[model samples]
Target: MPVTIPEIDYEAVFQSNPSAILLLTREFDIAAANRSYERMTGAVGAEIIGRNLYEVFPGGADPKKAPGPARVRASLERVLATGRRDTVGLQRYDVELPDRPGVFEPRYWSVINAPVFDTDGRVVMILHRVMEVTAFLTQLRQAHDHGITATPAEVEAMEAEYYTRVRELQQANEQLRTAHALEREIAAALRESVERQQRFVSDASHDLRSPLTGLQTRLEFALQDASDDPQQTIRSALKDAERLTEIVADLLELARLDAATPVSTEKVDLAGFVTEELGRRVSRVPVSLDLARGVIVDASPVRLARLLGNLLANAERHAFHRIEITVAADEDTAILQVADDGPGVPAADRDQIFERFHRLDEARRSDPGGTGLGLPIAREIARAHGGRLLLTDREGGACFVLRLPRSVSTGGDSG
Candidate 1:
């Protein structure tokens, strides 16, 4: 007769293993632990399972033992990164006493961290094995003191080696922290960029709806032969189409500015530039100019011209009889003001007027051709040039002021 042995239960073997054992996820969360581990740490299975490994065994305040946790973390990280086994010959990791709150018991450990690989040879989890060596180390120290088995020099050498390893682990831990901080910053910046893109899309869709709907309605009526004046209907449809085009163009310009593209700049004579720009465009409202000499600005000529054009167009729309343009300079600033003797902006609407696609009730009633983007575009140009545009209080009508950083004077009389 042949004797037979029953098949081994591997789970039971792991649970009953003589050494302390913990199974951890790639993220260092405790997936499971054996009974020996529970006995060694003086913690229950339910308390540590599904928690972070470090959270279960945090670093103690003792300066001598502080590096123990860092060493363990570094070893685990190395095992994960290399998919190979790593051994920490000695460590003084302290565990909290189960019965005593905030009290820790000094413990010495010999640790082995190994990869738990799946069928595809990918490391799925870490198998952390530890042996408590406090008694062995204690015995060796006692023997060294009493001239027994070990010498004083041997014990000193061992301690020096342990501290050396701790220093290396501490350095690696600091590097890991730096890398994590950089990752967080990059993630935050990406999130903000995505949010800005979302807002831009939302604003574009909202403002485009009105003109699109009007164009669709007019075309649908014209196609149905419901119009008494077909030619007039066609002209009105063309006008709506033109307005849609302008809105789209303005939106694109804003998008370009939002992308933070660098602007080209050169020194510009403020008074001369204003005179040249005003000469190109004739305003319906009578215009007066008060030009001051030696006002220079570092600016992009095309963009500055657009800013001035927008201000003039806005003034022409609202001015009842007269518009005044002024150019002057102070110690560090070049100032330009465009004032209109029209009904001044309401106190509540002054700031809102510079928001994209915002228009006042009076503006809608006065100028149907306005796209409501002029003031916003002007303000953006001003900001892009390292300047600001603001509505200042005036006795009558609205006063739009642009202030830019003044450049070194290339002195000349006003052109």
Candidate 2:
């Protein structure tokens, strides 16, 4: 009796594949390859079909090899014998193609393999599915080849073995660049935090020391007076105690703000906020407002108010008598500028003034804090809200501009 052939879907095999496909007989001859396979390998039906695996491009001379080991023939033969599948990294091989510029270069492949069965249910072919991972592998090869420990000959051999992988190399470089930027930012942030902490400690120490010294003097005088100075001494001691308590309170507030790193913001009108904020400064220094109404911003009202309030306080402390305030919002930003008539920031000190613990020469006259943490804290808040604070050096006085983006602003424009 004759054996009947079982129906198999040939169209679902090589021809229907989205990727390159091929069919090879048990003897390692190309029975067929799909259109994608031809395009991927840059080989034709006439050249590849009916050809032995090694006959066309033995030893991987061509850029793409038909499902076989280019470096180790013995291993591939074993896979064929066992009718099994495998995967490899960075295999340098070639396929014969029409000569184009630099056609001599060996194309590398990241590949996987499997076994195909015949109609008789016996293993008849080895299948290959390859992905190009050249760019990434190229960097790995270069890093390995040029290692500090490698001898010249070893380096030469490794380079010789290196197959170019542009994509992987570019990807790795970009990732490294991003990581380096983050590292630098983190390092700068850490340095700023340390300096701010130091300033807080120093200022508080000085504030405490003054009161303590005064208390000591009062105690000594009271001792000599013997009951005559009791009232004065008690009052002086109470004053010193209050000063110390205030210092402690300030320190606690700083610590609390730092501990709660990320704060939520509510959408609040910028114009109204500025108007209310400026109202407090009313006439202490003549103030002008050009606030555009209906512009809303996303920020913890408390933090944003603190930021604004500090700037206003600075102006009040330094201004010759008048301050100008303006508010505006563009497509994606809300801008607020405050200018005063005091001695403007000198060009040399503008950059350093924002640094934690940095104080301008004039800043000391306005604030004993000369603690220099206000600007830094303001900056931190701006960044947290996706915005920034910049100081402009103008002749009339120092103008400080705060830029808040739409992400932080709720009422930008109605249209």
Candidate 3:
């Protein structure tokens, strides 16, 4: 006795298969696409069921030249004509990413084109099978380029070795992330530095050009006017030359500070230092000093004196009636503050006050003789000694606070 077997459900099998599959009619129009095909191509079965294959994947042909599409068409024609299966080893078929407008991401596939037959042995459809092998091909190419030759057993071993090195790979990936972050930070810092240098150059050029141009014009006028007073023209040119010399000197000092030139340190009493420096300045502004007894600091005396001179000069220019200097020390730090009874600095300009060649617009309008580097030089000196000079809030005046580390030993000469 012979047993009868039940008929297989071919359509159900095609729909449920894990591999991406598409069925096209004899004219190469899409007849049916499974779930896997929809996922792979970002296509819907209902939308593309009757559309031409080339219309759905326009990338099958190169847009610029017709050869790409012609080649693909020729391959399909040959498969249909011979009623045989054709294998495409590798093809790049870029697809638009879902929800990403106008972005076609790259994809690679190994594909098979086989003819499907009807009951009368006529070619009824084309069965397309696609397997994405992008990662495998990429690794294979990289291994070949690196001169790695492996047998089947060796390949298996190499795969196991790759698994073992996963932790190391993860660590390397983390290091790469850290390195990228550091690179971005460095790039930003470099850009900021470049902008600062450009601003400095522009300011310096303008300042230097003013004096030089004036001097040149004075000399040229003196040469052209025979009857003009030689002595007066000579004096005017000398004054312009003097202004240029002062600007050049300030530039040199700033350059030295930027080069991190070391200064000799000595313990000196802050009270005596401030008093002596203030007395040296010939200013009509009535000065007041509040001295803290036995307050000493380790610092370069010359640099310290220069710092005080700049601060006093600035205060003398702006102060209306009086200037006050105070020296005090805590266990760890010494504070020296200078306050004036004049209009205080604008809030917006406070942050940029210590930048090189930065001058207040009002100051430039009133006092054209300033070199614009005084506050910057003073701040650089303070920083060299591990301290800071900052503008503190004050009512009706500008107040500058200079903080420095107190000397470890208070027993030093009160020079």
Candidate 4:
């Protein structure tokens, strides 16, 4: 007797496979789904099969506002038209749970759609495969909550890993055609993100290291001279610590400004505000105020005060004998100017002066205590109020002009 051979059942293998998979007709209607797909979507085969893809998984809360359906349909149509496989990056899809009625759970998936052709070389069905990556995204979010910063190198590695998997999948499905335009766009965005992260890290590290290095050097010198007055050494270390604190505070302020934090705005009396602020500061330079009365503007008082203080301090540091303050308002904009009697900023250096951590050689040599963040912070504050602070040309010294919109008001003049 001849031995009998058993026939292979490929349909049974597909139905029992662990990976979530769906078979769709040429019309994009679900034809069959594996056990894993049914479990993943919490839908019975009887309920989902023979239904349109979008009908089964409605895109988002608002049909008109969502891009999910269009994106998925486009990929499927591409596979049907070209008889090739298509891979999509991460997608956000919320699913309704069978156990919980009227409730949808957020889910993310990486999907691949491949064509299934007939004997005549015509596509008849689509094989849709999905891998759930919600847990991986959740882990990344949790790491952010724990104050873990991702480096540019780490981001590049993650992007490379994603494309490597995509390449492998394309190789496995030799008929797959990669979307070159989408790939180029993603690469450009990732490159930009990496560049921004690198610049931030470099600037932050440089700013932080300067004061720390000074503190270390001071401590070392103190240790070397045991007989010298310990109080003076302690005072010097305290000064360095204070400087570090100021740098950290400025950095925080810059971050907040960059984030566009909301500010409180109110009508401020310009003349009185300037008078009160000037009274608080004591400088050897002769200060003159030529303030116009009834000059008022809508601004955040705290921010305005800080801006003015920075300008005044800068002028005082550079002034040889006199510092002048002027306030005037026209029909549309209010103008405030601060002028000093020292060397004016060079035309070439004026543009770079407002950059964070930037300092002129002469300014640095004269004012060693300056953290080089004051002018930048002032400019940001000015911009936050829909205004501008500019370095205007002056004959004898640097002149800073602050322009702001005039607020509606009625008041008396105070010179």
Candidate 5:
């Protein structure tokens, strides 16, 4: 006797799948959502089905304060534009508690978004899938509270990456401070010099205290735990030391800038210079360049390169899909603009962005490696070379505009 096989229910399969999933319309309205998604978000399917994605779980009062929604929106837009899948790795997007109206609960998610193409090859819907990783991240946070630790091999890799450069550069800081003491002393006789010096000392002291305190705490922990792995303690100490070295190095660079160190100037082709800089950089986000030839600037090649690097680094910290760079020139000024598609700077904080040791909360949350001095350093370099760097207004993300005096003698070939 032959048995009849039942037809599989596609909707049943979609709804029963253990992973949290949602189907969104082209306009980002929730068309359908799975039970797992409902469970994960603590919302009923009825409440979210017809609402827009952002509306369903609004990113707090100040949208800028909550980067999760912006990132999600960006990823979805990318999928719609490219007709491909995009993955957002480990995002800290908090979810609103269903019981408590305005209060949000901390949540971490690993998200993947894919486009559902129609017969005409247009994206009709987006398949949004998310895995909640809050538990895993919470565990890691708890571990961090105890002490920083890494494997022996990891420590070796970090040392190879950070220690060599630090060792070679660390001595220069002390030497510069000692040799330039008299110069600083003479300058301190100026009107605002005393206040400025005191502020610098205070800022430097505060920044240095963090790593020093961490190092001391880790050593004390090692002393307390007789059974603690010596290698673990050493790794932790090395991590803090590396952080200290980085701070010191940045401080030294700022000191050199403050002292008005003289550097050699040359006729550089702006377009070609940017092209070379792009080649040396490795970025996760795509970069688009628009280079106009014959744009020349009289600049110190090394210092100008550093300024460009800092701008690129700042863009990388916030950029979502792409970073756009353009080089052009007017009759008297050479212009270079770097723009990103990430969230733009808030109006109130625009000028303060270049202040030393000032970092936006989002920037600090996203990038732990930054010294909060990149923009300030870039501005200083620009000023030193008789140029100016400004965070100009852009639609989607932030745009950094660099304008330098065009060189009268344009002798260099395109490069």
Candidate 6:
């Protein structure tokens, strides 16, 4: 016969071995042990397996213990004396189950004890096949003693971090107060100083215009004979003079808008305002209207009118002969939508359209797009009235939507 060695799965063989195998001396001190024997003692097989059981579980072996080591050992001794396997009650078995995460709660179990026979057929091995109630029995702590020990030295670090944040916030608040006080002082001084120069600024540019016009005429005539290409000189001179005149006009308009306080608070009908402005501005475009009525907004009438005019004018300048103006008013808000039937604004370029000095239509760039201030001025007016004008979306051409609060907060009126 051919000789062959049996293959052994060493890991599985140890795990499924029926008993807690322990090599203990006549004095019940462990010398050599298998995996199960270490578990029954609650000691690792390598360490306590070579040590005395009495020394290892001194307090653990008290019979007074409901499921104590002595009680467990007493039952095993009965099986050894008889050389017959015997069972322990559920009370003792339930106390000794293995543990792992997310496993079930332990219930009750029956344990069997026996002795392993050696080569001489003498009982030389102790075997404890302890049953499990459920594998999850060992998860929680058995019994724990706890007391809070507080010493002042341990708390110093936490106290310092709390105080540091308090100081930082205090410093930031102090700096804000200082800056606010300085701003108020400077604003008061500016008002007083400007009062002295009020008349000079109001009339100074108009006063200079007479001399500038005369000088411009003289320069134009002098340059007429200064070069043979006199037409070029004349055109340049005209352009500069026109630019100066436009600047003066802008300054005068800005001064007026800033210097005047709001004169009256009235419920100007936005639908009527839009209708009238569209008539004046959208002459070239075919306009579709969904005009909403009874939407009274709180604002300066002149400023409001200017805002609508600019929105309508912008739509006309960019559209392909057709535009839709939709006015939606509810109890809370009024949404004015101006949609053009031209190629809509590209998604990437929509944000740039409302920026100052931005003109999306290249063909109208030569007209200077009314100084590139129409949309910005419209936004300013909308903000002053506690409303906002926004360009919503442009599919092919664009859709501009203006959202406004339905009513102004006044001192007495509830609505």
Return the top candidate by TM-score.
3
**What TM-score would each prediction reach against the true structure?**
0.55, 0.52, 0.59, 0.53, 0.52, 0.42
Cα-based RMSD of candidate 1: 13.2
Model 3 TM: 0.59
Cα lDDT, model 5, residue 393: 80
In order of lDDT, best first, we have: 1, 5, 4, 3, 2, 6
Point out where model 1 deviates above 4 Å: 1-192, 226-228, 408-415
All candidates: CA RMSD (Å) = 13.2, 21.5, 19.6, 19.5, 29.2, 24.2
Q: Report, for all candidates in order, the number of backbone clashes.
A: 0, 17, 0, 0, 0, 6
User: Candidate 6: where is the Cα deviation over 4 Å?
Assistant: 1-263, 279-282, 361-366, 408-415
Clashes of 2: 17
- The Cα error of candidate 3 at residue 259, in Å, is 2.4
lDDT of 4 by residue, 312-339 (tens): 9899889999999999876667889999
lDDT, candidate 6, 299-378, per-residue tens: 67777777777777777777777888887775577777888876666778767766544566652562542545567667
Model 4, position 269: C-alpha lDDT score: 77
Q: Per-residue lDDT tens digits of candidate 5, residues 182-247?
A: 677677677477787788888889888988999999999999999999999999899989989988
Task: Point out the higher-scoring one by lDDT: 1 or 6.
Answer: 1
Predicted structure with the largest lDDT when compared to the true one: 1
Residue 395 of model 3: what lDDT?
Answer: 91
Instruction: Residues 1-415, candidate 1: write the lDDT tens digits.
Output: 8989899998999899988999999999999999999987787889889999888888574534587888788889988877989787567788877788778888888789999999998899999999887776566556676756668778766765665686578567557766986899899999998986786677778778878899899888888886458898889888889988988988877877777678788999888899999889878988999989778988999889988999998888889999999998766888999999999898999999997778899999888767788899999999998899999999889999999988855544433
Q: Rank the candidates by TM-score, best first.
A: 3, 1, 4, 5, 2, 6
Against the reference, the lDDT scores of all candidates come to 0.85, 0.69, 0.80, 0.83, 0.84, 0.60
In terms of lDDT, the poorest run of 10 residues in model 1 is 406-415
Q: Rate residue 338 of model 3 by lDDT.
A: 89
Worst 10 residues of 4 by lDDT: 170-179
